[model samples]
Target: MHAPDRPASYAHPARLILILSLAPTVGLGIGRFAYALVLPDMRDTLAWSYSAAGFMNTINAAGYLAGALFASRMIRRFGLAASVRWGTLACVLSLALCAITGNFYVLSFARLLAGVGAAAGFVGGGALAATIAQSRPERANFLLSLFYAGPGIGILASGLAAPFVLQGFGPGSWWIVWWAMTALAVVMTIPVLLAPFHARAALTETTAVKFAVAPVVIYLTGYFLFGAGYIAYMTFMIAYIRDAGGGAAAQSAFWSLIGVSAFATPWVWRRVLALDRGGLATTIILGVNAIGAAMPIFGHSVWLLATSALVFGVAFFAVVGSTTAFVRFNYPPQAWPTAIAAMTISFGIGQTLGPIVVGAITDALGSLSFALNVSAAMLALGAVLSAFQRKVRSF
Candidate 1:
């Protein structure tokens, strides 16, 4: 296949891919995931019950799962550009709804819609980018890493930006944060809209044949655990830090540090992936995650919290990048997106379960220590699973 003619600066294919990918990161990260950071404020402002807040998260996760399952079909029917445009528009409108409505039910509905939009945009955009970089699979891996890195950047941006917005503007500023994020989503669409079409037509027959492999199933299981463990910490870390007697600044800084580490992950993991044994390298990464999760339980100091963020940030995205690379190495190109979607669905399932399970433990036990312990256990199990991954040619 001849390379698509490159766009001028603003609409280059790589730039479009990055922009489309960023829309989901902002939607999922700031619109959906950042809810955890602002939950205390939202609950107090709205006088929402804990169950109501929990249900909102559940709805968001359910929507994400639905979108992931349907994304491939949506892209096949609508084409990548249309899917990206509409999906991003949905996310922007959903966040706008969130900014306008104070009704808990309405806000929850908007969040659910946002999740659906984010998943479709992310999966479709990622697949488009991967297809464009088919000749340079390693570059594809790097672009996918950039795709996943969007959420971390969003989280970091929200964490730092929200506190400042609240401090300068006073209470009920969470809505303002959503409004700003919505604008960014709209801005993100411009680059994507201007870029040349990069997605090739799908090969249904070849894809169907490639989806039958057993290694894919095992890979998905491992990814599910990764989601469970990672989300447990990400969702609660800000609250956990505050509850541990750290001030708001400390909490924000901790998340920012995680973001910084996450931003540098692709560069760092290029070295990790260069190691001789791919499976063993992944196991070591998972083990680092286990230790990171356990850090808060063992120490309450601000330094310890910072250490945890660093450990988690560095290892988390690297593991995800490694998983995608592993899948691509083991499967044919046409099947990559489906394999990724399957793994993502499993991961989303685990993520949905994580917050509820951790919330229950915190409610009953009056601390997050038990939840952290469970996270550690899950990561350790993931490490064990990584060891068993059939050694494909390392990326």
Candidate 2:
């Protein structure tokens, strides 16, 4: 048994931290990550061109970028609770609107709204978690890991849920899934609202911290490459599998495998960080992702797909954990948010362009294999960047 004054392992403080940390994951993962899973279905139903679908993703990333830039001020002015509630409400409403209509313009608008809401939620939640973890470094690191795990969980949940929901309800039932997701979002918001807001000085700082900006910039570049490869894979993996003659069960299983692997990321990276060579670890993870991206190009076999998913899953979460931890260790406490925001914005930019670039590549080559290869190349570039980043400690 643990000491009573030690916050009781996994009790109030731990549970609260976990819950709040999960808010961004649900907000971004469900609202954003799930969008890709459903896109193929939506495209078929709505007769959307590839460019149109890609544009939707770009719009969302744009909103997320804007929200990240402004969210700190919003939280400072309104407090964490109000910001969370407002963001949740926006997400719920946007998803609801998406369910009710198939108009391309309206769908784009809804996605934008959802993106903005998700961004706000992510920024606020991350800031809050960082604040709480400041004094309790171990707990803080755990909470940070938990925050990123939300998306992996969301991806797994949606990947499993989307196919069954679509099959059971028949055509045009994508709206039903959206509505259900909206309901889930609203329900999840209740717990968040009830939880006490533990304000910390680390949460409110908007100024640049002590780290040299150059290395941070290089890190952002690598981060951008990561976003491109990861998003492209996530956005199209299910469809790619299905297109290659895999059954619905196979597709679902593939995503589940990815999710399960992703779920272990925080635990794995925690050990990696203990080595105190986060830069090298990051390079290795990015290289792994590049290899994963190349797997599908070899063949469309089910075994290959499964292997690719697992590799991608492990690499994806590990990279996120390593990069975020890198920021925490390298930067001063006050500048953490700005550094994170800067990195996230670079990610958003990559994500914003990735889908469209993939779509264009697919159009040109008439196969996802080419697109996957392009993504692999980008990951390779990121790996190089990661290695180069080690020389400069300031950024």
Q: Give the best candidate by lDDT.
A: 2
Show model 1 residue runs off by greater than 4 Å. Answer: 1-17, 49-51, 137-140, 199-210, 274-281, 391-395
lDDT of 2 by residue, 1-395 (tens): 11111222323555666677556656676787777667778888988766677788878877777777777667667765566667766877887888898888898888888878877777666655555555465555666676667667666776678777877887778898888777777777777777766543323454444435665577788888888877777777777887888765887788777777877776766666434454776788888888888899899877888898888887777676666677676665555566666667778788888888887777777787778788888988998887766533543
Query: Model 1, range 17-58, lDDT digits (tens) per residue?
Result: 566556566666666777776776676788755445556676
Which candidate gets the maximum TM-score versus the true structure? 2
Model 2 spans > 4 angstroms off? 1-13, 79-85, 200-212, 275-278, 391-395
Q: How far is each candidate from the true structure, as Cα RMSD in Å?
A: 3.6, 3.8
Instruction: Look at candidate 2 and give me any clashing residue pairs.
Output: 212-394, 212-395, 216-395
| Cand. 2 TM to true fold | 0.89
Q: What C-alpha lDDT, on a 0 to 100 scale, does residue 276 get in candidate 2? A: 45
Model 2, position 50, has a per-residue lDDT of: 67
